[model samples]
Target: MQVCNVCREQTPKYKCPTCKIRYCSVGCYKKHKDSCLPVQPPEPSGPEVKPASSSAVCTDPWSVEDLLNEDDIIDKVPVEKLQLLGRSDQLRDLLRNPHLRQLLRSVDAADSKEDAMKAAMQEPLFVEFSDCCLNIVEDGTAPTHT
Candidate 1:
């Protein structure tokens, strides 16, 4: 039994002529051709040549720390960490955090920003109070009948 190249299912066939991979079915062969990375010829591996320095006579290779650059700070601290320092108005920072973005979007109302924010905070309080009253009435936790 031949195995599918894409999904690894068993079938009667063994070869895919289009992608040149062993496939169990036409579907497997087609899927492989659609998404596989293009095969490239292997390049000969050799030691890289370094440019001759005229003035510097140091004989040792410099560590990554020696290559300290402005870009290095960004590479060191992830984008998520930098976002922590950004203001609320920074959309780049907000969008990067889906939870934050969702919270903001959920709060946005047609009225003024202040009103929208106040309303957003009130929703949880309202739900909590409603649930407490409901449970008390349903479970006879409170003396309600008169």
Candidate 2:
């Protein structure tokens, strides 16, 4: 059983094939997509090639860490594929917030992993807020301030 990253709920479930991050459900999976999407790697060079030799490095990204790292989770999506994620209106709005944009900029510019993660977590309510937005979008609903 793996623990859900968002809620920390423990359950047996499938993991994201690219990120190897486990989620209890689709809701939880989509919750992480915003942040997770940025880290996906680029596709391998050259046309889709098959190998007759065992020495060839497989173009498949997920296949490596499963055997190499054993416990570490790494995202394995192509860089081109990742660019499409930023096209969403939800993501665009989030990026428009000045503070968030600044924090994201700092995180991207950070030289250390620790600093990057710290910067990324600046808005502690981000995940929950994102969840609420997703629920609204999915249910064809909207929030009312009145």
TM-score of each: 0.23, 0.33
- What are the per-residue Cα lDDT tens digits for candidate 1 across 1-146? 44556787664243433334556566776667777654453575887655688554443333343444332332244445444333233323334666544556765423355566666456654344335434443443332323
TM-score result, candidate 2: 0.33
What C-alpha lDDT does candidate 2 achieve relative to the native structure? 0.58
lDDT of each: 0.47, 0.58
In candidate 2, stretches whose alpha carbon ends up further than 4 angstroms from where it belongs are 1-74, 125-146
Output the lDDT of residue 49, model 1. 57
- Candidate 2: the clashing residue pairs are none
TM-score of 1: 0.23
The best candidate by TM-score is 2
Number of the top candidate by lDDT? 2
Indicate the residue-level lDDT of 146 in model 1. 35
Clashes of each: 0, 0
